[model samples]
Target: MSQQARIDVISGAYGRANRKIEFPKNASGKHESMSDIFGTNVFSIKKMAKSLPKPVFENFRQQLKGGHTLDKVTADAIAHAAKVWALEHNATHFTHWFQPLNDTTAEKHDSFLSLKTTFDNGLAEISALETFSGSELCQSEPDASSFPSGGMRTTFEARGYTVWDTKSPMFIQDGPHGTRVLYVPSVFISYNGEALDEKTVLLRSSSVISKAALDILNLIEPASEDHPRAQNIYTTLGTEQEYFLVDRGLYALRPDLKTTGRTLIGSLPARHQQLEDHYFGKIPTRVLAAMSEVELELAKLGVPIKTRHNEVAPCQFEAAPIFEEAMLAVDHNLITMDVMHRVAHKYKLKCLFHEKPFKGVNGSGKHCNWSLSTDRGENLLSPSSTPETNYRFLLFLVAVLKGVMDHGDLLRTTAASSSNDHRLGAQEAPPAIISVFLGSELTEVLDAIEENRAVDRAVAGTTTTQMRVQGTTLDLKVATLPKLNRDMTDRNRTSPFAFTGNKFEFRAVGSKQSPAFPVTVLNSAVASALLEIKEDLLKQMGDKAVASEEDILAVIRKYITLTKKVRFEGDNYAEEWVKEAEKRGLPNIVKSPEAFKRILAPNNAEMLTRLGVFTQAELESRFHIMNEKYAKEIIIEAQTLWGLLVQHVLPAAFSYRRELSESAAALKQIGAEAAPEMKWLAQLSPLCSDLEDISEELDQLLNEQAPIEDPEKAAEHACYKISPAIEKARELCDKVERLVADKYWPLPKYHEMFSTL
Candidate 1:
């Protein structure tokens, strides 16, 4: 049948009027005392200091801030204090929370309900010291087999250990039913010492970056009379989270959405984002209430969510927190996602973070804003005015350029995902190609350094930097330098990595993904690059008797020349860019499996291992894990399509065709012209035929159980085989939708689902 006829039938399928529900304006304001309720459940530093002995508290603080190893005695004392604080906050249960191979946080809660007997032979109480200990905090065993271990463990080997992560602090989370719970962030590992969790690798990567940063700082500013107080380097990050909030009633009616967290089959709604009024328009009353509740909940947990705004898409919105330590930022982002879902339910909304939840519209992404900072509170990525500032900025900037250039494949791997594949390279999102967008100001600096031109320090806001392409000047202007207060260049949505003032916003992260993997990759890659720069600088300055400042500047200039290929100032989505990127030798890894395969390459593994981010085994495990995830996702999607076709679409098509045939026969018996009914039957006949053919093919594919021996091949088949089946099914279902009568159609139409909101 024609596509238009099928669409018309599907459009008339749903006749019932949707029930409208009103949301409370002050649903989030139930707990009015913000300060009193905020962090009341948390075992915070303030709570710790108050609960523990002065000496024990001081020792534990040193361990947390200085990264010192806590002796067994100190660990015991710390645990005792933590138990007291948790109990005081009404936390009856404690959980060792960790991020496992699934890339989502997990926890196994244990109630503090030890059996106790008093002298009078009655059950009594246990002291705080008796309740908590180092051994208990150090390790825990959860069911490992239930998680995706990538063939690392079997059902019989259900042993997984959670080890305390001394760096991240313990906190409390408030859940439904007024339960206050204590949460300890930790790392999960197997019996053989293989890293079995995302947190373990991320923590290791952070340590590597911190060390490398310190080394670079020391090399640039050696300990001398003038240059004293060199300290540890730290990384800062902020994550911009985008999500869609649909009415819960509409969401519940859609089986595909209920199962897959996205729509599997739905034609475009006429008013969906096409009007463009929803982008930064007045927030809908229901959505605003939902956002308010989410914000209030997150703030109580100390998430520091500073910005909330309407995103480009219709029902989509974005929230961002103030920059914090990179690891903490990652934790906050995870917590925020959880909070969003929880509060969404309270406001009768469903928050969708799937990258492309709705096709034919903008997808969501988590823009990871990353930067480097010195212990002395200076942002290393921020450019300075004086020669000293300029030299330091250029040096760090070049380090980043070199990092991205050398590990472009790794960067691509960092963002590879099945959901993201549909978003990337589209006009509204970043392209698959990895390149750095250093605005006109910094681009000129790199060009000048490459050609040994005198550094331009004049206040000429519009000075043009000339290029030597057949004596053709590129007319690159040093436009009015945005002030420190206004440092961010205009955001380029199409650029995968863009410099936004003091940090690089990695815009390629899929919305549903945990930022841990990509952030860890970024930290590890930059650390390795900085280590190389430090070594090269040391080699070049040996016994030169040159000024330290001048030598540092010279080294930065040299580094710029070597790492300039990664920088771009124009549209990354342009066809011209595809050709230019190829000429520059950048890897354009378009598929998740292919991109993930790079993780196990010899050099990539070597670099990661050297930086202590991952062992060779750990790296191989991740490669297996990502490929397995991709394959499984495709399999699930394919299975969903198969079910929808067999149980829903095909049956509905046949039933509709039978009704059309009966109606045409009735008209002919009445001795009346049945042209309209005949035409309808003609359309229904072809649709029924097409649906049968597609359904048969889908059944054959499912029954054949195509040989998928390896994860990569399985994922490839999913992309090529399973995805097309889904597309074909959707096309047939949409066609049948337009022909079938409203009472006969089983699923809700797009107009009823989207327009009702």
Candidate 2:
């Protein structure tokens, strides 16, 4: 494109962004009360009660809570009631929504209209009527061969099933032109029932963890006739989603952003998040409008969204939901991402969930705040007033530490992706090394416990620590622990996994990823750890009916000492920590290719298979699939950068250079000085030449890597060869972008794209 055309596009984007935004509304003009709007679109318990018979409703409720298989009769009743409730809300079709092997949601819609042949006066006639059968709701067949199966299914093997996930609530999703569809959360599987999707493994992991936790609970505190114990336990998650917003018009003009979900080549703005003023600053009007609609839509879908605020980067924002069971929370988070994107489009803004959408700024991450709970509403990770005395909590905490210590390498693989590679190890985000950060308070308690010594609760001759906040002395002393705040000491945002108050935040999860994978890995690892602790305690007790507290404490101390290397309470981003982590024998697997390769390591595979979280075939398939995905993503980004450079950047730079040369010649012919034009020419020539050379090198590298047949080898090539070349190309492009005049720059400038909104 020519300089003039580029200028025209930039101006058009500005005009579109400046236009008044007309906010969308539902059938009702304005939003009602929060309580009124909440769960309006969901088929909640109230809707079920109103639609189903009392006995069926109670049975179905029990089945859902227990995660048991629904009988045919119960399935039919629930399906019929769901159909009725959906119809009442103007839904005409239903879909079995499931997360595919890819980290995104997929759905195939079917109209509720069923054609039946009825004889009228002995004549066969076809009539259409609304119908949804139990079989239809229970199972759906979509083409499995088309999805990423990693040699699990061939092209001829097309059968795949999506079974309704009873634990996750069904909801109605609105579409264009008043179209509403009932979405039943389901699990996708191959024909033979080998685990094929994320939800299946996640469900398996949840069950294993629950059973393991119950075993430990029974061991620690024996249940008798007087006190019956809870039957099951489950993990909970609250995902903090961070993303960026840019004008849709500007997004449309940028080829790299359109193709790669990130800006492949753009110079940093004069000021971008450097002042740290965008963090918690007053939100821009257009962004707030989009956010309001997004929250309302999510609330209606029963997504319990509870927080929203500006992030550390300009144009970046975050939205978080309250904690829910791991399975339901995963579904809700996927729904939240969809809603945010749709609502942002309604406001003429493009919501970007890419881990690193822009260069030289804080990247986005979905901090998975995870915890464990019992059926009786006990938070296993929550420390009571005196954590030193809470042996049960200490045991559970040690289980988590053992999980991370044993499988930290595998946990690091959960967040591995080509897109996330750019964000990890950056200044803002956590490093690839997996380390657990327990605050100073808990660290001290654990150290004392390991040494078999009582905690020195009193500091400076007092057990209470008073904190002064703006001349207001907030009494923080709540007991031995001082009622640990969200950040117990200084906030350790640099830790990949940090224990914050009642939960451990897995902060390394990429923003765009489904939390099911990471949470599954976590749950499975912790279950294995918990079972090990239980075995150790049992062996120590020998034939004794009840274990002594000393035995339990000994087992806990053994774990704390064994997993000591995985604990780091200091700055994770510091250079010293990296060297120290190496000395401590922790695996600092930074490259995603290496991390993905370790997924099927003997220890990881054995633990997962032993716990029944994943079969050998499923784990092997994942290893293949992740490598294939990583390689493909990098190649696509490389191709996008090359295209932008060839089709957009180079042409614009050459055109501007020619124009400058012509202007200088004209001035020289008129007997005038052309120093400014000559200076631009001198600065522009070298950058453009170097960019052209790098683009050729990138093209050659892609051609060389095109013939690699093995996914693992291809991934390594992409990571080492293509990835670094892409970075070099990016640097050159950024330099050329800066030298090129604003009007002549092919893509919208960073300052313009960010500030236009």
Error of 2 at 163 (Å): 0.7
lDDT of 1 by residue, 1-757 (tens): 2334434433442332322433223456653554554655456788778877898788888887775767788788778888877777677888898888775789988887675544445756554433877778777888777776777777888887888887677888877787878788888888677788878788888888888888777666656777664566778999999998876666766678877777778777667777777778777666776777777777667778888888887778999989988888888899999989987777666889889877778899999999998777889887654322377777888888888888878988988988888889877788989999976556666666666775453321223353211211233355575423223245677889988767899999988888988889888888988898888778777975333876786788787878778888789988999899999898888878778888987778889988878888778778888888887887777677777777777777677778877887888899878788778878888887887787788777656535676877777777777778878878877877777776666666666555433
CA lDDT, candidate 1, residue 454? 58
Which ten-residue region of model 2 has the weakest summed lDDT?
465-474
Task: Give, for candidate 1, the lowest lDDT window spanning 10 residues.
Answer: 466-475
lDDT of 2: 0.88
User: Each prediction's Cα lDDT score?
Assistant: 0.77, 0.88
Query: Model 2 compared with the native: what TM-score?
Result: 0.94
TM-score of every model? Answer: 0.89, 0.94
Q: How many pairs of residues collide in model 1?
A: 10
